[model samples]
Target: MLIGDVARRSGVSARMLRHYDTLGLVRPTGRTVGGYREYSAEDVRRIFHVESLRSLGLSLKQIGRALEDPAFTPSALVSDLIRQTEKRLAREKELLERLHAIDASTPTDWQEVLRIVELVRELDSPSAARRQQAVLARPEDVPVPAVLLAGAILTEPDTHVAGALRWALARSGGDGVATLRAGAHAEDAGIRRRAVLAIAEMPEAPGALEVLTHALGDLDTTVRRHAALALGRQGVAAAVPCLVSMVVEGCNDVDAAEVLGMLSLDPGCADRITTALVDELASPTADSATRIRLAQALVELAGATGQEVLRQLAHDDDGDVALVATALVGVLKERSLEDQADGHS
Candidate 1:
């Protein structure tokens, strides 16, 4: 086959075939009477081989080494090609995400497009300060899409930046709840924690409550605690068990106790919350510290059941528990007297 026929059949352009010949990648095996390049069957096969390697993202120089160097092993080169392909894929994916975010913003002109691009770039910057500033300094006119903020919060490692991202998402008026719902179920505990934290701030966001309720069973303790606290504040009685557990485990127990107290304001939930607390105190495995924390949490409750529990705890075996319980009892009594006075007024 001549160069023209070879180019036509192999899908390698004539110019590229000539370039390959110049580089000794696939030289013509013969010449015709007119001195044009002619390719034998084997030469055409080599052209196809080069095209195959090129499709795998191999550079011409690497292809030369791969085809001509008998001592070259493909294992390391193939691994390198895999890494390069993966990097290219990652870049493309990032570009696609940026485009999607920009499109979601529905920019009206080139200037808005540039602003969205710059904001996306800053959000992905290596500097935490730059990322934070990008979120904070975003121009009021250039509205950021909530999905973009949701994606940022899921991957943000910096506490302050994550907080700002969550705030920005919340300010978007619950638009990113679906994205956050996916993040809440992520296999990465950190991502799930971030998602739950962001969702917690958007309590009124559509589907936010459902996401929190599902996150209550998260394997990550922090995720469950945050979800529980958020749910409790929403007056969801389902959070009572986790809130009581937080008190017993001493994990943000004070906040958990406060939320539990708020939940107990519901007449329907008061007895259930009180009973859960009393059960934890009664557990044989309950250490004095756990019992003491539970005792303190009881003060947040509204009913006489909590005061009765405190009164009993005041005479308990642990002197520290007894002392704290005694003080709490007096505090509850004072609160009750104040309630009576207000009722009279």
Candidate 2:
């Protein structure tokens, strides 16, 4: 076969076949009387072989070595090719993710597209300051995509950056709670905690309350405690038990006690919370330290219920408990007199 015929039969362009010949990758095996390049069957086979190897991402130089170098071992070259391909694949995947995020933003114009692109880039920046700035720079009216924000917040490890990201997500006014729910159920404990923290800040977001409720049962005490605190402030009675448990475990007990006191203002929760405190106080296994903390927590509860408990504890065997309760009783008495004086006036 002549060059044109070889190009036609093999589908390798004439120019490329000539280039291959020049590089000694596949040379013509013979020549006709007119001195045109002619390819024998074996030469055509070599051309096909070169094309096959090229399909595997082999460079022309590498293909030359592969076809002509008998001492060349493909195992090492093949391994290198695998590594290169994997790297390329990873880059492609990252590009695809960025594209998807940009597309999801639904930019109205080139400016919006650029803004979204810049935000995404900053969110993923290696510099923590840059990431923080990115979240803080978010416009109040233009919301970041919830899924993108969720992804960034879940992976953010820096304390400041994570907090900023959470604030940004909260302000997005989107259904970020559903996106965060994915992180809440993540296998990574850090991610789960981060997700709960972000959701805890979003009191008004749809489904946020439900997410916090579910988080109260998380195995990580930090998650449960944070959820309880947020829910407690939001007046969700579901947090009462967890708040009580935090007091028992001595984790954030003071804050828990304060929130519990606030919850007790509700007539419905007053009796139940008072009873829980009284039961814990009367537990035989509770040590003096536990009893002291519980005593202080009881001081947070207002009205006769808490005051009555204080009176009972005042006579207890533990001198410290008695001393603390005795002091609180005086404080409650002064406030009660002031209240009476104001009412009478």
Candidate 3:
């Protein structure tokens, strides 16, 4: 092992080991062609023994003498180590007993701890989607709501879970999409939130967009956020006006960001979105970030007229909105117009 690894293992600094080498207490067994020192397993054993002796209040000089092959009998060293180890074991056993007593008296929350450990294990397990699906299939064994929520959470970190989430989501609607919509109307907020999250993962799932919009209008923030996230995944510009209207008219900053994410995929649809943002930009209801995100979304969607529209928007009262608009203008201006827009068109 190298000096650092040895130092860390033996509780001796690498510098001290080099000093030990100078005193002939321990020396590297060999050197590389480039002259780097190397130690063998034998050297490690010797160094560790020296460190053990030093910790028990022996001087380095005394440790060196004790470590020398001829200076001390092997039986003497073995006996000393056995005595030290027994004392250490006695102290450790006392601590462990005290810990066990406290655990028994305090009512261990091992159930919660086990649940968390399982959750972490689920995250690390291969075929996690399948594992979640297996969990979701048995409502009698696993709480349906927790299993459903777990499946939804899995879909975000893993694409493989998308299919599993869709399976659970199908159970939400008779088809999953329809069920999620029904859940949105359910008296239980957890049902609605989980439903929204599940539906959002499968953007192309039938009736997903409509359910998401309905959820956005729901009195729940989490549902609205999931709706926005779903729309972004859907990448359908037809939903832009609805998103913009929600942002300009709604109170949540988070929802606006989600809708803007939708714009990233359809950069050709900006002009349609700009009309909506411009109307909202003048309103007291719209915030700077909201307006800017909408403007950026527009530029991304309307790559054709994005640059020109952005330049025109630069002088807008909403400074952040104008900045994003201008940046989009720069991106659109550099593209090859002939390649993207043919003369026949």
Candidate 4:
């Protein structure tokens, strides 16, 4: 077969076949009487092989090595090709995501497009400060997509940046709550914690209450605490058990106790909250430190049940528990007296 026939049949262009010949990748077996390049059957087969390898992302140099180097092993080279292809795929995926985010912004003009691109770039910057400034300075003129903000919020490490991202997410006016709820179930504990915490800050988010309620049972204590705190503030009685547990564990127990106290104002919730606290107090496995923390939490309760618990605790065997209970009871008595005085006036 001549070069033209070889090129037509093998799908390797004539120009590339000549280039391959020049590179000694595949030389025609001989030349015809007119001195044109002539390709033998084996040469055509080699051309087809090179084209096949190129389709798999092999560079010309790598293809040369693959075809001519008898000592070359393909396993290592194939692995390298796989790695390069994966890297290219990842880059393409990132580009597609950025494009989708830009489209979601619905930019009306090139200026809006540029601004959205700039903000997206800054959100992925290596510097947390840049990421934070990007979120804080986000163009209110054009709304940032909630999905984009949620993605940044979940992975952001800086506390200030995360807060700013959450704030942006709150006003993004889209499905941020749903995005956060999905993040709440992430296998990454850090991501789950961030998701719940961000959800907590979006008070107006639809379904946020339900998501937070579900998060209250997360195996990660940080995630649970954040969810429980948020739920407690929302007046969700379901958080009572976790809040009481937080008090026993001394994990933000002060804030937990305050929220629990507020929940106790509901007549139906008051007895339930009191009972949960009493149960933790009665647990034999609870250490003296836990009992002491629980005693401190009792000060936030509003009813006679809290006072009765305090009275029982005032005689406990742990000296620190007794001491705290006695002091809290004293403070409650002082408040009662003050209330009576105001009533008289």
Per-candidate Cα lDDT values, in order, are 0.90, 0.87, 0.61, 0.87
| Candidate 1 local lDDT, 1-345, one digit each (tens) | 898998889888999999998999999989999999999999988988898999988999999999889999999999998998899999998888888877888888998888878888888899999999989887766688888899889899999999999888877653888888999999999999999999999898888999999998889999999999999999998999999999999999999999989998888899999999888888999999999999989999987788898999899989999999999999987987998999999
Which lDDT tens digits does candidate 4 get at residues 203-256?
558888888988988999999899899888989998898899889888899999
Worst 10 residues of 3 by lDDT: 141-150
Q: Candidate 4 overall Cα lDDT vs. reference?
A: 0.87
lDDT of 3: 0.61
The positional error of residue 201 in candidate 1, measured at the CA in angstroms, is 0.5
Clashes of each: 0, 0, 12, 0
Q: TM-scores of all models?
A: 0.96, 0.76, 0.40, 0.91
Query: By lDDT, is 1 or 3 better?
Result: 1
Q: What shift in Å separates residue 101 of candidate 2 from its native position after superposition? A: 3.9
TM match of model 3 to true structure: 0.40
Q: Please report the TM-score between candidate 4 and the true structure.
A: 0.91
lDDT winner among the candidates? 1
Candidate 3 ranges beyond 4 A from true positions = 1-182, 203-210, 213-216, 228-238, 245-272, 284-287, 303-306, 317-324, 336-345
What pairs collide in candidate 2? none
